[model samples]
Target: MLTLLLLIPIAAEHKPLLLERFRVIDAPDPATRAAAIATRADEIDLVLTNGTVGFKADEIAALPRLRLLAALGVGHENLDLAAARARGVAVCNGAGTNDDCVADHALALLLASVRALPQQGAALRAGIWRDALPLFPHFNRRRLGIIGLGAIGQKIARRAAAFGMVIGYHNRQPRADAGEAVYFDSVARLAAWADDLVVATPGGAATRHIVNAEVLTALGSGGHVVNVARGSCVDTAALAAALRDGRIAGAALDVYESEPRPPAELVGLDNVILTPHVAGWSPQSIEASVMNFVANVEALARGEPLPTPL
Candidate 1:
């Protein structure tokens, strides 16, 4: 039986299925995780981690019997892919498992920000009416720009299109399958052309601060920005400045630089909406993500190609 070390938390309901398949070692707490790896380094064969709580090079080096590393979600940003390659440890992730959930949340944020739903609702609670509150932009007939044209971005585009919004996107390269959507080579150009911007790009050093002050400025004062991607993709300080200075109309974020803690910079601002990094989290998505991990592990055991290798 393969020994599986879990570095990320799994829901209580999902734990039983994993326990039935492998000799599971649950150590989500950082200190306990370190102790587990040190004590059972030789026994561990497969390791399950998320994109944020990645398995580093040092940890990979310590595990002599490790053969496979799997991320519960699409992100593998913090995963030390180089070390995994050197050690011949196959890496896989649950790419499409949560695409629908994430895309749904992205659209929800976009609609809320563009229409100032939260602010309006708050006003009503404070004994204010629509006449006292500032009028917000309509969601329909606006230009929507997406930073990434990946699986999730494409889904967001389709949803936006249903609302009568014109779609545009920026990617490292134009995708042939993008369908009717206009493509911009640079992020700045995309922002300039768009009335609203949605960021769905991957996170890492390369993409860190891809959406900065300049991009925010290009988005213009009438525009709103929504981020369902990694927080590192947008500069938090810059976003706060933009919202404060009216560089952009408003903003909404599902992910921010501060993971567990709230983003201190934008929390005071009323124009911006924030949700803890839960855009991709839902019962359906969680189940699919766990099942995807199980499939990858089973494929690894049978020497079959992984469904979603990173």
Candidate 2:
């Protein structure tokens, strides 16, 4: 039986399914995980990790028998792809498994931020009425700008379209199948044109802080920003400043530079809404991701191409 070391936390309900197939080693804490890897290096043939808790080159080298490295979700930003390539280890991820869940959350954040739903709800619960509270704008018939035009971004665009939102996007290059969504070459231009900007791009060096001060400035005083992608994609300090100064109306985020901990910069701002990095997490999505991982492992065992190789 192949030994699989899990560096990310897995739900207890899902452990049985993995245990039935592989000798699973569960170590989610960084210190515990490192010790476990060191002690059982020789036994580990497959390693499961996520973008945030990435597997390093030295860790890859420590396991001579490591044949496969799998990311639970679409992101493999922290995974050392070069090391895996050099070592001839198969790399795969659950790419399309949680697209719908993430997109749904993105739209939820967009609507909530635009309509100031959370703020209104809080005021009502505190014994305030609509007459005393500030009125927020409608979410429909506004321009929605997406930073990434990938699968999740496309899904968000589709959902936004239903509400009469005019879609626009920025990418390295315009996609051939973009259809009616207008394309912008630069992020600032996209923000300038959009009433609300949504970030759904991948996390990495190339895309780090893609939404910075300049882009936020272009978004104007009435604009709202939503990020369902990596936290590193948006500069937290910049976002906090913009929100505090009323440079931008409001912001919502599911991910931030600070993981497992709240972003200190934006947590105190009433204009911003925050959720732990769980935009892609749901019962349905988790089950699909786990099954996708199983399928990839089976494909490797059969010497067939992986369904979603990175």
Which candidate leads in lDDT? 2
TM-score of 2: 0.98
Q: Give each model's whole-structure lDDT.
A: 0.93, 0.94
Candidate 1 yields a Cα-based lDDT of: 0.93
- Which residue pairs overlap in candidate 1's backbone? none
Candidate 2, residues 1-310: lDDT per residue as tens digits? 9999998878878777789999999888888888988899989999999999989999999998999999999999999999999999999999999999999999999899999999999999999999998778886779999999999999999999998899999999999998899999999999999999999999999999999999999999999999999999999999999999999999999999997799999988998999998999998898899889999999999999999999
Pull out the clashing pairs in model 2: none
**lDDT digits (tens) for residues 1-310 of candidate 1:** 8899998887788787789889999899899899998899999999999888889999999999999999999999989999999999999999999999999999999999999999888989999988887777776789999999999999999999999999999999999999999999999999999999999999998889999999999999999999998999999999999999998989999999998789999999999999988999898899899889889988888999998899
Q: Compute each candidate's TM-score over C-alphas.
A: 0.98, 0.98
